[model samples]
Target: MTDSNIPVTEDELHAYVDNELPGERLAAVEAWLATHPDDSARVASWRAMSDTLQAKYGAVADEPVPPRLSLDALARPPRRWMMGAIAATLVAFVAGGSVGWIAHGANTKQSMFANFTDDALDAHKLYVVEVRHPVEVAGNERAHLQQWLSKRCGYQVRAPELDANGLKLVGGRLLPGPSGPASFLMYENASGERFTIYASRATTEATQMRYAANDGNGAMFWADRGVGYVVSGPTDRTRLQHVARLVYDQTEKTGL
Candidate 1:
């Protein structure tokens, strides 16, 4: 047991996420976090961020160290340009929008919620390019599409109305997802711009909405009621967010 009088610090929260928290204080911090929604959510976000980074880089950690980086090599005299090159590399890394750069000042990288958004982004990029058969079902049959998807996905699936956002439903299809079957829906505006929404059963019960960008595409991801949703579109943050807001609102009202 820990003294409730001793307040938990930012460092403690991070150590908890890293699984390095001292056993003596662990119970107290957990008890405190249970009553604090903000801190609990922050901890969840950190765990998700850590999971995302591990999924991406864990393999690299297992690779053998390069000969140039070995102890024998370290004993040799360094080149004059080595220091300058190291400095330049760090600068370029920060400027290149790497995940480490995101962790430098803020928790923006916490926006990544494991593999859910990655699958969504990949699906969006894959089907958005189709001029012929983009979807298995056409948008004209919205009711049938909804029923079919709902049955296959084992949940009530509703397609949000996005006409107000100038995006007309281009239809949807079934796809393999992280957990189980996924429903993929596409939308398009008059200018030929495209967007997609992907939903499926999620291991995560709930999460705050977060944004992630890949290649040239962007995604907003959130989970609710045992389902995960990702809205993917152009890298224009404002436009993507606007569409995502509409989808989120509809899902909330309709209870999907």
Candidate 2:
């Protein structure tokens, strides 16, 4: 719609919603929105929600803090038991002649999917707010993205199709893992709610799923053959499990 030939992008739309885009790009976005009713509605809804949140909570900064929340009152010296705990941990690592601290329990019988769960949730929080460059490869380049990440990670990485559900793939990227490379895939629904799938090489032969909750997010992590997969989303346990089943089914069918 504008003189520029460049097509509108999801990042541009997000920036427009958050008012982060430069002034020069405003006209192009508005012009694009004019022709796209769906995007226009989405933008309006986002703005309304943003305005409501700001209006409802914007005054908290000026209010007097509650006694329990006072920083000075809450400050304290570290617990005495913590010192002994640290010393014990150090001894365990050194005596075992292992990779030390970080990998102290690597040989344990526990499922290593727990580690990927934490990483997946961290990645979700980091990239969810990004207005631009959310992924190294966009969904439109699905084939190339799969090939590129697969080669980089030493596995056959396939983008799980969730289009049948309300969610659609946004894109994916390559990320570092505990031992090597990892692949991250992002998806979003019409309501702008998002989910992420992170995959890396397996550290254990665990095929059973591991469920974990952290902060405000939840994940279902598992390992099949040589690959580990984690599906992460908000802390709605039932909903996250539902989405996890879809991911598990798709990846299991093409896990190679």
Candidate 3:
């Protein structure tokens, strides 16, 4: 699709996926997906991932609280004359605090990725389920779609070539991005399994390569220059990486 209609930012997408978006905005995304096939498939993969993650990790919220982690115990002070015991407890607390900090860091990263993944999948899921108007632009209009997206994003955008990898370019759509607007291209195998290559101008500091799985969805994200790219699906890590490499190669070629 031509980029002119792409939203100014991906915040709407984030809100949509997180179920925080309301009324017209949600309706707008749904309407866009209804006509976009490639985007629809990507949304499906995202939904599967979200569902899988929720099923596996949702229980963390319900887990039993350990006595040492109880708020009551933390609020209580050590009794008088317990100097040695208090010292030991303080040491343990420091060690535990360090570990907790590290864990929190990791979790924060996961949560951020999950939010993006959820947005991608939600967009995919909503549009793919439609019988008609699945894309704002059809695959048959590749040249037009490319030109439009490129102009809108203020960068040359090309659909990554996936023919050699047993997937065919189904088409693409312009979507909102963190910095501005972005695009998502969908590819599929004969079995109907699909994957998406999503890209946007990088708005955050450069982040190291990272892999994560949510619900049953897999995502690989990396940033370079001022662009961020994420390739996501329910495919195995090897398959996902293979696609990711192709996307990276193509993105570089197109001057991402």
Candidate 4:
């Protein structure tokens, strides 16, 4: 392992799930995961997905192709009109398959954003532990923080007031998101409980808020006007949803 303090990356998580992480790094990753419940949950999800895929397709790889799809069958001669019909059918099939694959690929790309929750959770965990320098800009400098994040993110970024929900803005920072530059805002309540909001360019234009929770962490994700937003906090679903709704309402009113 490079260093205990070095952050574990998304690729490293994947490698760990695949059992391909280097031996030297294994202990470090495992130790890091021990304290990061969100990451541990993500690892478990990946393992489950891998197991499900193997169970569903493992037999297919060992099976022989159907006779109709064999080279011999394809090479057999046919009447000229039959050959013409086959060619026409094949052309139609290829065209339809191409369109199908394109649509499937697009759907796949959109679905990949579900992983964005992981990124939000990771950022939440990384900074929430900071005692003094939790954010690059302090909450007192809200105007500057918002303006800086907006300019860098190429979007109108707003740090929604959470006072009504018993949370106050702590600060914000810029981050690299799945799509592009992201704006991250942190909020803390009187008890020092912290929450974060991550916003960035989105693949989808608009979406309803959806919740995902791992261990003790919860996040609600949505997209609007070419931007995606994630609200992350502790795993209190009702409380988290209330906070997320406040953020959502503010964005709607401000047209962000």
Q: Pick the candidate with the highest lDDT.
A: 1
Using lDDT as the yardstick, the better of models 1 and 4 is: 1
Candidate 4, residue 92: the lDDT equals 56
lDDT to native, each model = 0.77, 0.72, 0.62, 0.75
Candidate 2 local Cα displacement, residue 38, angstroms = 7.5
Q: Order the numbered candidates by lDDT, best leading.
A: 1, 4, 2, 3
lDDT of 2 by residue, 1-256 (tens): 4445468787788889878888888888898889889999988887765564344333442445433222342244432333444575678766875455444344331425545676677776666554346687889999999999989889889888889898888899887664467788999776667789998876556677778887566888778887888888877888988998898888778874
Candidate 4 all-Cα RMSD: 16.6
Judged by whole-model lDDT over C-alpha atoms, candidate 2 comes out at 0.72
Query: Mind sharing the TM-score for model 1?
Result: 0.57
Scanning candidate 1 in windows of ten residues, the lowest lDDT window is 103-112
Cα lDDT tens digits, model 3, 83-188, are 4434545665788877755555455445445545555554444333322234567677879989988887887778877889898777777766543566777776
- Ten residues in a row with the worst lDDT in model 3? 125-134
As for TM-score, the candidate ahead, 2 or 4, is 2
For model 3, the superposed segments whose C-alpha errors exceed 4 Å read 1-115, 128-131, 204-206
| lDDT per residue as tens, model 1, 1-256 | 3376588998899888878899988988898898999999989876765564355334444455444323353345543334444465587586786665545323322322646787787777666765446799999999999999999889999999989778999899987765467899999886567899999886546787888998778999998988999999888989888898899999999977
lDDT of 2 at 196: 91
**Given candidate 2, what's the lDDT at residue 194?**
78
